[model samples]
Target: MNTKIDFSHLGDRVVYVKPVAVADLPQEVQAQAEGLDELFAVHNADGVQLALVADRRMAFLLARQHDMSPMTVH
Candidate 1:
């Protein structure tokens, strides 16, 4: 039942990925979300949000597309 994760020591070769609920999005984002209830987010080494993606694969792909290395935390 524990779903928490510790990413404080995550390596530089990886981009942190997490899920975000549609309701938590900003008004502009929520309005453009259409019917999606959730989205995945990609973050860089400094914990900066890089992209909001529709799925996990897209997150990984985005990192690669941006020339950054992606490592799976799980």
Candidate 2:
């Protein structure tokens, strides 16, 4: 599948969504981006792919389906 989303530098962290393509992403990021299709298609809602960074590295990607109330991170 092809997507138009891109990444941008958000101060200290890199944000992916606006100007990056899935094919251009790093291996780890490609995996995260690929999962969005399933998340969006199954839930039929806006999903959030939160990428957490530390020491200039991607620590994790948190996928959350849209809900009435915001989700809590722990």
Candidate 3:
């Protein structure tokens, strides 16, 4: 599931990986999450969400792939 993504626009920054309940997400987002109760969110230093992934490992891998440092929020 490693789709090519362009991350050159986002300068190098520390990103945070946090867990989020699927039920708490918007209806459209939750609808796409089949059989998933939880997901991981990658946020920038400004607290802006950059991506939502299926697991913590994916979240970290995504950030690293984009040249960003990843840290666990909890």
Clashes of each: 0, 3, 0
Q: Candidate 2: global Cα-lDDT?
A: 0.33
Error of 1 at 43 (Å): 0.5
Against the true structure, whose TM-score is highest? 3
Model 2, C-alpha of 29: deviation from truth (Å): 0.2
lDDT of 1: 0.79
Instruction: Assess every candidate by TM-score.
Output: 0.71, 0.24, 0.82
Across 41-71, the per-residue lDDT of candidate 1 in tens digits comes to 8887788888898888898888888776766
Instruction: List where candidate 3 sits over 4 angstroms from the true fold.
Output: 1-12
lDDT of each: 0.79, 0.33, 0.91
Q: Is candidate 2 or candidate 3 better by lDDT?
A: 3
Model 2 steric clash pairs: 5-20, 6-19, 6-20
Candidate 2 displacement at residue 1 in angstroms: 36
Regions more than 4 Å wrong, model 1: 1-11, 72-74
lDDT per residue, candidate 3, 22-68, as tens digits?
99999999999998999999998889999999999999999999888
Worst 10 residues of 2 by lDDT: 36-45
